[model samples]
Target: MNIGTAATQTGLPVKTIRYYEEIGLVTPDRRANGYRDFSEACVEQLRLLAQARHLGFSLEECRRLLSLSADEGRASRDVRALAQQNLEAVREKIASLSALEAQLQRLIAQCHGDDAPDCAILDDLMGQRGN
Candidate 1:
């Protein structure tokens, strides 16, 4: 098949598929006419990459995962550890966002939004309120 067929099979954009190839993720064979000839294995690899990206895996992480997936003697624990690390990072981001929400709510509450020029939100942002 061609790159378009591979992109359709994987549900990835043609540009993304090209970028993956540029990044050494998937390598389709080149025909004598200098066109990319995608194999079934290449399409399968693209599908796996799509799934991994949907799960929020970085490209480098996906590369490691693809390597481990190809290893016949790979341990399940290794995959679990990587997933755990990603989970922890997600949790940390959630906590940080929650804190940011709270701070924004506090600032908004302090602002009266009236015709008066005394804006508490600006004061808070300018360090006049000492954060």
Candidate 2:
């Protein structure tokens, strides 16, 4: 089928599908008119990519996962290692976001949200207070 058909089947945008093909993620055949001709296997791969992306897998990580997924007897140890790495990343993101949230809360609490020319929010941002 065409790219549109494949997009409908996989629920992915046509641009994303083209990007996947360009990045060697999926190699769909090209017709004489130069239109992309997708196979069922390629569409299935696209569906897998969409699912992996939804789970927050990076493109390179997804590529590695795709490689591992192809192996029927893939080592569990490898999968475990990747999962651990992703866990660490998620933990770090949570820490950074928490810190940002605290700072924002402090800033907002100090802000005068009223209609005043002398805004506390601007003052705080300009390093007038908070030593």
Best by lDDT: 1
**Which residues of candidate 2, in runs, are more than 4 Å off?**
none
Per-residue lDDT of candidate 1, residues 9-75 (tens digit): 9999999999999999999999999999999988988998999888888899889888888888999
At residue 119, candidate 1 shows an lDDT of 97
lDDT of 2 by residue, 3-108 (tens): 9999999999999998988898989999999989998878888988999888677899879877887788899888777777878988999999999899888888
The candidate scoring highest on TM-score is 1
Pairs in clash, predicted candidate 1: none
Candidate 1 ranges with C-alpha deviation above 4 Å: none
lDDT by candidate, in order shown: 0.91, 0.86
What's each prediction's TM-score?
0.87, 0.86
TM-score between model 2 and native: 0.86
Which run of 10 residues does model 2 get worst, by summed lDDT?
115-124
Candidate 2 lDDT for residue 110: 77
